[model samples]
Target chain A: MERILFGDNQFFAVNHISDEKSRAQAIKFKDDSAIIKVLDDAMAAGINTFMCTTHDRIANICDVIRDNPKKYKDFKIYPCMPYAHKYANAVTELGIVGTLKQYVPGNFFGSLFKGGVAYINKDFISIMELLVDAEMKMFKGINTPVIFLQNVITDLLLGLGMNELLIAFAKHVESKYNAEAGFITMNLPKLLSVLEEGGIKNPIICASINKVNFRMSGGKELYEEVLKQGRCRVIAMQVLGGGAIPPKEALEYVANLPNVESILFGASSKQNIQNTVETIKYHDNQRVLVE
Target chain B: MLKVALIGAGKMGISHLSILGAHPDVEIVGVCDTSKIVSDVLEKYSGFSCYTDYLKMVDTTKPDAVFVAVPTKFHYKMVKDLLDRNIHVFSEKPFCLNPTESNELFLLAKKKGLVNQVGYHNKFVGTFQEVKKLVKEGFIGEPQHFLGEAYGPVVIKKKSETWRSDPNEGGGCLMDYASHVIDLINDILSPINSCKGAMLKSIYSKQVDDAVYALVGIESGTTGVISVNWSDETYRKMSTSVTIIGSKGKIVSDANELKVYFKSDEHPKGYSKGWNVKYVTDLTEEVNFYLRGEEYSSQIDYFVKAVQGEVPNTVNTFESAWKTDLSISIIKNNSK
Candidate 1:
């Protein structure tokens, strides 16, 4: 029986904390106490895989692990760095001014000019360059096997004007970063396509099993397609439709999927963690019929 | 093996005719409709006798069961007449105009011991069954709340105000559209203790609301909200989703998609994520069940089963009366 590897993404925040300042503050606070607590709890349940976003969060978490390295000697942490540079043009074009213009339209150009040249410096383009530089610097000698998480493909399809561009960006990342990193997070279709491009021998694709618009095909059809392609490994997440399914059933449903290496579950509370452990244990005992 | 007569050579009626025609144990003996052209077309397509008058057809064919797929207004008289002739009757939804009429039919069916069934196809849908299983397993902890929304715009001809558009003819979004949601709620959330709903006249400004919304409280104190409309321009979108927010976890059944998210004690994370597809096999099992007649196959099957004494009238006249009565009461309360 293959072991069911478990992990939670973004462990510190109670809710979906996306703001850079708050996220930075969360990890750096008190030597990253919040992340340590989550990691310690996870390790105790025989789940040692840790995934985090951004270099600061990873550094803070690593610092905590190093404080008592022997305590987490057996644990492994996988950091996810954002590939924000890929959408540099789109992000840079609509900076603070564009965002402001959306809410309060009409004299955005006047407001921009009045705000001075410093406002233009804060555009998405400048920010993207800065972020890419920071990321490149962060990636150097980052010998740890990291997984890069990308944004939703649907958004890219509608917003980016071309699917080929998205595909090219993914391919570029794989070729450039394959030696240093482990795999890229993506859906089943994108994962197979990326594998066909052939830079990374093994790319990890994170597929969601939830009620989202991206799932145009049936669950069975999607699963069958992935299995037939047999290209790229996959991590199944969102089995329960983002807290929509009951925990037990969600676990069972996910555990039943074919060729799933690990499942990423979101735990907001301590009790949820305990329940998840129990559910995994129960699933481990049952025979999963993978056709 | 029982012989069945189908009335109303419409889309739904034709579906029944084809299905029944293929059933080894059941035979479609006759088909009746107001339009002679439609009746002839259906009869030729289905290889069954055609009739201009349903009464004459029923008397001649002497079918063991009669399937009423005509308009809701015609259901009362047709079903009543069928029951009087000691023939079992199965009718499409909106059993009658009001609960009183539905109850009257129910009493008659009961006295005659005729098998009766209403078409609530969602009850037999596979996704709903899966959600039910998850709920029973305590997946979403103790389900405290549920919310559902279903909307779509099916083309309706202008100036031809069909029975579905007229409130008196059992035509309206609430009756024609929201009826499925109501039945779905009943199937998934058993024993709804009390329901307090509001029917808004949002979109269509004619006889009834083109959009309808409702809030129901189940016996277990679990609250549910349902929103339905026929105003969406999208092609035939029917989403009957139920979100069960429980004490321990949450379960969302967004149509065929089921998702569960819960907190775990272990902090496991990695980007070495791969996509694995999980096929919902139970759906196929449900389709087989309905096709096999092990589960009720709409009203016609129920009528046949009732006549054969294989199963007691599970959906008797009273149940229809009660459902319609509840619907009317809900509508009346909303009007007030």
Candidate 2:
């Protein structure tokens, strides 16, 4: 695992700051080549891991990567699954029955009946497993070291007290995919405790971490306490606080933290990619010297 | 025509066989291998005679030269027998398992006035060749420090029943993989003078080391470090690179391209002071070999030209590889 991982938020226009900027990004990166160009720029700048969503266009990206095995051999993708927008759109356009028929694997008619029965019985775990398998079908042959449950589902599960589903997701990801399950949550401190209760020890948790308490739900102090005391592995995302903190200060703060294993970020331009990577490395070296 | 015989049907031996068999001015007289299947296949396709015993093949074919691509453990004995018959020889690198044997073979070749070369084919890579050219041209003036790295997924798991995993036969990453980088560095810069520290770690194989790290000083007062790992699965292919720092500028190179960064404007024409990247495709000769890049064929062509007495053996000579073996000796001794 690299200390720096490039995120795919910019490609899908998931800008946290403003919807206007998000729409602009969505328009800017409407093409698959645009996404690949930025990823190549990140690779040239020495970042190897792409912590990304399972967006439909990303399947095209995976096609490019699979075709040129020599160029992207070392490049790994940490797929954040269940791109919520995709599912929502599919359900709206096709209806519930049609969506289930289209997405579910195995005998289509059999799956429809099974899905109907499961929905009637409120068997959300079976539905969740089927959806996970559906989401994972895109990255069939690629190297995905960490399979992340998107924060939407993670925080939803956390709010519902459905901790056992997290355990099942982790176990399925391990047994079938042979990858460690990662959870992205707004409430890291609570999620850590719940995940521990569910038997996922030393879970890899990706959360918003910044200097000014940007998205640090349950506050920043509690997050820090859990990071210091808990057994969870931390990957700090939104270190810039949705463009609130200065890049240098935000990176310096996160790079000097105690238990953050990696920093995940998104940038559109080559210069920005190079600058951010250099800044992180520079600050990391400074921290090493000071300590 | 120069008559050549090949001994061994392993990976490198196949590379040499294809190049030699395809040469216009060369005739592959025989190919000798321990496996009858391998020998029969070569003979069927190449129309070259095949034999199980190398000595018998040499006696019958009476080849003008021999390409010894066997394992390192057999290089000394096989090459010594061929050289005793006053035949030109091209053997693979780490000339032998022992430096003493390498020195003896080198001297014997010189005494016999026979053309002798080692298979440090990296020297023929277009980017590496350009790096050497820039160094000799004083582009990176007065080398200060150099870093050589070679990493790949050659032995990530415990591999047994192969000579490569045996320390006495293959010498693990230090000998099998790092030798190429050491040979390249020695070719580009000054010879190593002393080793400060060295570590050989066995990650998967119990009998041999899979990783090597060393800090050394060259005779020109330049510090150098080399790190090699044969267990890195992150690489889709083997990654070997060299970065050299100097007072005026620096040259960073790999198999694909060369990046030159100059501090001041004293570089050759078409190159500026700041930075320039040149890919091997732009500098490499047209590829003629079947399995590999132009460098593989280029090395064989150089050897064929050397054997024909048209050009002196300047690259990958026994003497040069003997020097690399001396550095390997120092590294292995220091690590222990």
| Best TM-score among the predictions, by candidate number | 2
Question: What's the lDDT for all of these models?
Answer: 0.55, 0.81
Going through the candidates in order, what is chain B's TM-score? 0.81, 0.97
Candidate 1 i-RMS: 21.9
Count clashing residue pairs per candidate.
Answer: 34, 0
TM-score of chain A of 1: 0.62
What global local distance difference test value does model 2 have?
Answer: 0.81
Off by over 4 Å in 2: A1-291
TM-scores vs. true structure, each candidate: 0.49, 0.56
Expressed as tens digits, the lDDT of each residue in B244-280 for candidate 2 is 9988898988877678999988898879999987766
**By lDDT, who's the top model here?**
2
Please give the DockQ score of every candidate, comma-separated.
0.01, 0.01
